[model samples]
Target: PQHAGISLLRVLLGFAVGAGAGLALGAAMGLSRRVDDHVRPLFTAIAQVPALAWIPLAMLLLGIGETLKIVVIAKAAFVPVAMNTSAGIANVPRALVEVGETFRFSPLQMLRHVVLPGAVPPIFTGLRYGLTHAWIALVSVELLASSEGLGYLLVWGRQMFWLDTVLVAMIVIGIIGFASDKLLAAVEARLQRWRTDGV
Candidate 1:
């Protein structure tokens, strides 16, 4: 239970950091052709590297600590969020944008009333994918280095040749990840309902 809490905390912290950065980057790319042209290719290349590839480098730079775990997880989370967010915003209906323009809405007003609503579904999709990635990365990091968390539990069990313990940790991890995804899906569904109603 204690280890589970620790892992959850790490996941949340990392997800927040990644999501914030992703939203900013995604907004820039989605809103500005110039930014997209400059950054999209670079981001795509970097994202293709995979979070696990950063482990050794992160360990060397940040050491095997909370910061390292958080950074790795954040890297894992941000890519999907950024990509989805950019797509979402870019795909926001032209009709809605036209309406905003017809009303002479300010930029912030257009974003709040037009762009964001249309983009909510995809944004939520991004968040869901981001969280899944974050959790996976966190476990991989914990398995490689750390003395606590479910991933560490799995590693410890294997090292001690405790098959049952390892299996239990694996099951628990799957269950937790599934439950988290389901919860987010539920939230997304609710938001979609609201968006439809508002429209």
Candidate 2:
């Protein structure tokens, strides 16, 4: 339980950092064609690199420590979040934007009343994917470098030849990930109360 808690905390922190940055950048890109044109190409290239691919360089730069894990996890989370957010904002129905403009809404009011409602669903989607990516990167880093945490739990199981332990760790990881995703889905559903779904 303690190890699981530790892993969860780290994943949450890194996810928050990466997802927040991505959300901001994506919102900016969606709001402005100029910003999108300038940043999208660079982000596209950077997103091509996998989280594990960044591990060695991160280790050299930040050492095999918490910072390294957080940075790698951040990379894993950022791409999906950024991409989804940009898409969400861009896809906000033309009619809705027109409605807001018709009301002569201020920029802040426009975002609050129009943009948020349309964009929130995909933003949550990005968050969900970001979280999953963070989990993967966290475990990978832990397996390679950590003294403890859920991923190290797997390492310990492997070293001790404890198949049951390994199986349990894997199960725990799955349950946690699934539960988190479901929680996000539920929140999305709540926030979009006018929409109905089979879920």
* Winner by TM-score: 2
Considering every candidate listed, which one attains the maximal lDDT? 1
Candidate 2: where are CA atoms >4 Å away? 196-199
Write one digit per residue (lDDT tens) for candidate 2, span 54-150. Answer: 9989889999989988888888999999999999998999999999999999999999889988899889999999999999999999999899899
The clash numbers for all candidates, in the given order, read 0, 0
- Give the local distance difference test score of model 2: 0.91
Task: Score every model by TM-score.
Answer: 0.94, 0.95
lDDT of 1 by residue, 16-105 (tens): 999889999998899899999999999999999999999999999999999999999999999999999999999999999999999999
TM-score of 1: 0.94
How does each model score on lDDT? Answer: 0.93, 0.91
* Residue 99 shift from truth in candidate 1, angstroms: 1.6
Candidate 1 lDDT trough over 10 residues, lowest sum: 189-198
